[model samples]
Target: MPRLLSLALPALLAALLAGCSGLPSRSTKAEKSVYQGESFAAEETFSRLFDANVEDTCEAARRALLSQGYVISKAESGVVRGAKHFQPAGEVHVEIAFNIVCVGDGPKQQIATAYVSAQQDRYALKKSNQAASLGVSALGSISVPLSSSDDSLVKVASETIPAGEFYDRFFTLMQRMLRENTASR
Candidate 1:
């Protein structure tokens, strides 16, 4: 009985150690994926806008109107809002909303409001293997999903613009209409 007990104890100890050794590797992989996904989403969205010079784009659009001999009597601060989602298959989708208000005094005060929405569907996957092997960087390779669809792009844009800008423009136009009516009297 003593001999049989001694053999069983060593085998049990060996099995326990083997299980513990694999736990750290699994934990590390999960941790890496979470951190990488967050960083990748942030970098993708901001980089595109900043690179495309969105500020410049807005300013230029404003300037073009001004050059046409229309005075800009008042301009309101623009608003931006957006949300992002990530998929298990390694894709990220983003939706953005933008709004601007501008008013001018002519025969009457005229207001122009513009709304825009945009989306980008691509993501970079973290180079987990390289990160583990190199031990120097955590950045990953970027990829576009094979099955990404453009359906959401238009839907997002439609929601962003029509209600906000259309109503704003209508009110501004109404104000002008009222002023003209009063003047004609």
Candidate 2:
């Protein structure tokens, strides 16, 4: 029994040590410094300093959202907020929120960053029934059955768009808005 126990312990220890190698190991100081050379998780900010003033930037942002069918909700204090609700299908509905904040003085220029967040929801049809009582029916006092349906939006998921392409497209559209807004005046 002692001999078998001694033989099995080493094999079990060896197998356990082998499993640890599969995990990521700590890097050496030099190797770690190499990785730190570049930023990995830095937030992608899409802000551009425009030649126009702050008020014009805000107006351009508002007009950009409006042109894209977004309903402007708030426009004050160098911040322009807009939202758009659109239906893609019979039951799927999506709402996108556009928040553009401008910073800097009106005399020189301003920089604005637009953030977009989207939420998707699906509507479900629910059927319900009700019993109604009628004092005087054609024949006698009777009861009637009624059916109704209602839709409720179920939010499945939501997230902030972290892609650069989306922000680039938005900024490009905003640029066009600024140009047009200035052109009109």
Candidate 3:
């Protein structure tokens, strides 16, 4: 009886833990997704090949982002990051981040490739109780700001934008930027 109880206890605990496992199940086919310049999917990539040097590629990306009304927040040696926010309807806001990275192709030192990844996040307005300080601290009670935050409508959805038309237009614009940059110099 004691041996059976011991084995049962461990089996029960193991079963509970397995039931709560957060790992993917065997039947689930997780698609490869890339966020920013990082690739979470080993088999998937959304990068376009640019035949320019790293510096020129990154600069072109920066200009392309700015042309589209994206705010350029960071520009570094081989990486450019930008974001844009807009509201299409009431109480709904959408944000997109553009992450571009330029690197040398493994087999070709002279050839550099620029990779672009866009991540999107959606948010919705929410209302919550707040204690407004009507000029007086109402019997020494502190007041909290009424509003300034919102809840994410969904988990941040990230995917590589490898659509032919989309990337073709994007690369064409980037090429124009690269040409302009060269001309300016």
> Tens digit of lDDT per residue, candidate 3, span 77-129?
89999999988888777898888888976465555788877777777766554
TM-score of each: 0.25, 0.58, 0.59
User: Quick one: ranking by TM-score, best first?
Assistant: 3, 2, 1
Per-residue lDDT tens digits for candidate 2, residues 1-185, read: 99999999999999999998787766633355544754544466556666677778778788877888988889997888888887877767777777677776444345443434333334433445555554657778766655455556776656555547877777788789989888887
Ranking by lDDT: 3, 2, 1
The all-Cα superposition gives candidate 3 an RMSD in Å to the true structure of 8.6
The global C-alpha lDDT for each of the candidates, from Candidate 1 onward, is 0.38, 0.69, 0.77
Candidate 3 regions with alpha-carbon error over 4 angstroms: 1-45, 106-108, 129-164
Clashing pairs in 1: none
> Higher-TM-score candidate among 1 and 2?
2
lDDT of 1 by residue, 64-139 (tens): 3343333444333433333334343533333322233322323333323333333334443422221122222455
